[model samples]
Target: MSIKGKVAVVTGSAQGIGRGIALRLAQDGADICLVDMQIEKLQGVAEEIRKLGRKACAFQCDVTNRSQVFEAVDYAEKELGGFDIIVNNAGICITKPLEKISEEECERIFKINVFGVLWGIQAAAAKLKANKKKGKIISARSIAGHTAWAMLGMYSSTKFAVRGLTQAAAQELAPFGINVNSYCPGIVDTNMWTEIDHGCAPEKGVATGETWKASVAGIALGRAEKPEDVAAFVSYLAGPDSDYMTGQSVLIDGGIVYN
Candidate 1:
């Protein structure tokens, strides 16, 4: 699946899954625009892409802010000469009991995970349409989006919203030749999962590593997920092989959820 000469914009690309996707796309011969709140980390990823001989730049933007996202997209397109892919990988997960999930937490999660994706799609769609270019818009979802877990009520709800928006945008953008889709990952060993493990450690009465271990035990593959696992799938979707597939949230959860 070669995406040579294409340009991709990846959000939350400072590290973890987003960083992995940015680097993978670069490796596959695509110029990349790395977007994240961490300016230093973003620059690091950008440097790596440059080392690989790809034109890359890092943009500091908060996904939750629609204007910032639009500006970032515009900047990326200008710097990269054109744009073909936008991965709305910037998201947040605040694990807590249902009773403990405050309105502020819920709204913040939606703003980042749900609204952020929406803003990306809207901004990218406009640019792709204006350029008369077909594009791919991908977002990050989760297995919890398919089946809600005990302490992740709010995060699950946000991913669920992402799934919904992906389908809706896919259908709406079809006429413009822009495909919208999402990837649902399970138990990726990223900092997000580390935070989940630590946050639920006391409430679940388990040690920090135990929560992640138990979750892995339930995986049919019996293995922990890595950021590259998710990135590989995203790379496929970003490439031309997935042009026929849209309005869908493909799961890469190690068989954690079958939907």
Candidate 2:
């Protein structure tokens, strides 16, 4: 499972699951290109990767921007000397009922969650094909993607779209030896989950913390998901062990929404 001497680009790597994935990849001996709009936090993650004895570069990028996504890949290949894996982990979650989801909100989340992954697939495939290298393209999905939940219909829709993109891109890029897959997480103990809990609190008529507790109540593992849990799976996806796998939107949510 070693990815030693490979180079990887991880988007939204400034915090949470992205940060965990970047660090895990570095720990597995892959040089990293950390991409995010949060420049300072990206630098911090880069420094941590450096401490792990892996080359790291911090590149600020808006994943929703097609050109910026392409440039980020270019920068990664140039700075890290190769591009073997791309983890399109940058995404935003919106909590709103389907009935009340406005046009603007729908567009915003779709741009970040759907279009961002699309551009990532495009950029990564292009680079890998040009270099004649086999690689992996991973993206972030959610449990909502597998089964739609209340107040997260629109968010779920975008994730489902990501699953579609992953499958289609996998087939299209298979000829080039590029694999496309996604990770589906649930109830992660991250700022994003905190935001989701808060958003559900008002509708559920409960306090913020209570909503989060209610959510964790359904987990078979009896605990909230962690960044490391997801990172561990992503490390496999980015390594040789998963080379035979593609177009899979795997659920790493402690047995939640099992498929």
Q: State residue 97's C-alpha deviation in candidate 2, in Å.
A: 1.1
Worst 10-residue lDDT window, candidate 1: 101-110
lDDT of 1 at 192: 95
Each model's backbone clash number: 0, 0
lDDT of 1 by residue, 130-225 (tens): 899999999999999999999999999899899889999999999989999999999998899899999999998888889988889999998989
Predicted structure 2, TM vs. truth: 0.98
* Per-model TM-score versus the true fold: 0.98, 0.98
Query: Model 1 Cα RMSD, Å?
Result: 0.8
Distance from true location, Cα of 103 in model 1, Å: 1.9
What are the per-model C-alpha RMSD values against the true structure? 0.8, 0.8
- Can you tell me which runs of candidate 2 are displaced by over 4 Å? none
Instruction: Note the residue pairs that clash in candidate 1.
Output: none
lDDT of 2 by residue, 1-259 (tens): 5999999999999999999999999999999999999999999999999999999999999988999999999999999899999999998888878888889998899999999999999999989999999999999999999999898899999999999999999999999899999999988999888899889898878887997898899899999999999999999999999989999999999877979
